[model samples]
Target: MDLRTANMEKNWQLLAGGDRQGLYACFDLFYDDLFRLGVSLYRDVDLVQDAINELFLELWKIRERLGEVRNIQQYVITIYKRVLYKSRHVRQEFASLDECIEMPQSSYEEALIAIQTDERRKALLQQALQQLSERQRQMVQMRYYEGRGFREIAETTGLTERTVYNTLHNALQALRKGMERVE
Candidate 1:
């Protein structure tokens, strides 16, 4: 009837007919809406993207059986919501150590382990920071330890904002590799 509705029906038919291009077209058309809905429901970008990916994968798997529907958009959204609901329901909440009565000793042990782990992580991070070049290290310290913004760091160091960003990016990559080696 209408252009949007007509397009949806055509795409749905193509999908039902096992046309991969149609599936891609449908993804292109609905991806933004699905992303928005998933984010609103789940509040995690990675989770939302994963859900969308899984949803599309499942749709492709069942494309042949996917019969005609009055509203393709609504149909896809319903599936997305169902997938999210099942994922959300499957999670088991763990009580904090403070909330558990029987594990006080275990809690203390866990706390000690956590503190040691944090110290080791800090030491590794410091080592990684030291591996950075002088200019890169200065940029990182100004941005992170000094709590200065990129613009402020650039102003103080007499570098452009883009240069400051590039320096930080390279520094972070090096730190990541160094930390991985430490791990």
Candidate 2:
């Protein structure tokens, strides 16, 4: 392993051993470098920040595997790269770095208000889903909530692949129009 990876392994061990301060220190050290790489690809500052947040979230989620990561920088870079790759593959590439939206920090009460707003939106979506036909609901749930590909949904539902694809597309368009009306 490289020297950086060796140091990372040590940090991972420390973190797994409950040394949170050490983990945070390592995170701070790597954050700027990783963010630069993410920004280089994504161009959007929010995407850069989101990529870092997701990378860190994945790191913590797979903490048990951290010790196996010989190259800490490599691991973090891979996370950001994979995120960018996925975003591009999913057709969600950011428009531009200059177009990044900045969210202002809110006080405790405002945070609670924001949380309630999010809850209402989620409830609205749930209500909309409930209004979908059984087939539409199943397709939506499979494609999104369960993260299945069209081919996979076809296999599961015994529908032809084209039928599954068309159903999902139409269902999503309907959902978009429905949400527009609600909004």
Candidate 3:
């Protein structure tokens, strides 16, 4: 077998054997591919990484099922697609909710209550985040989560500084509106 195939098989076997190191190694090897797949669909590198990280965590939760995976890379890609699918789906679902769910308050108090650390809470946050557009989500992550400066984000993303600031501003505005509605 070619070296790549051999390595894949070996890692598969190790993962099937419940080797933590092997699973981590596999994650490292496939991270770029999975991230790229996420970016291709979502057009936001940061969200891609977040989605991949979430997927990897979910994979470990089902590690015993690894042996059934005939193609590890394909499995990972499928998971990434599912994440993207959910993001898009959630956004669509919320699009129709304005007339159904009561609109959130114009202020932030009730929205802050929506965030909690329980599984259900995290799931709620994930669901809300999924409703965001790709660029909006990325801007939120860079500005609030990563604490990145607008100029740095602009340089990294090839956007003008003004554009970065505007994106971040717009994203937060959208998020606030969404959160108020969903909250």
Top-TM-score structure, candidate number = 1
Per-residue lDDT of candidate 3, residues 21-88 (tens digit): 77787778787677556655665444556677777677777878888887777787888788767766
Write one digit per residue (lDDT tens) for candidate 2, span 17-133: 657765786687787787667656655555556667777676677777676666566777887789766765554454555775665644445544665788988887887787788
Estimate candidate 1's alpha-carbon lDDT, on a 0 to 1 scale. 0.81
lDDT of each: 0.81, 0.73, 0.71
Best by lDDT: 1
Q: What is the C-alpha lDDT profile of model 1 across 1-183, one tens digit per residue?
A: 888778877887898899998888888878878877876666655556777888888889998787756668788999999877766555313545567465223333454466579899999999998899999999888988999999999899999999999999999999999999989
- Listed per model in order, the count of residue pairs whose N, CA or C atoms clash below 3 Å is 0, 1, 1
Ranked candidates (lDDT, high to low): 1, 2, 3
- Alpha carbon lDDT of residue 111, candidate 2? 42
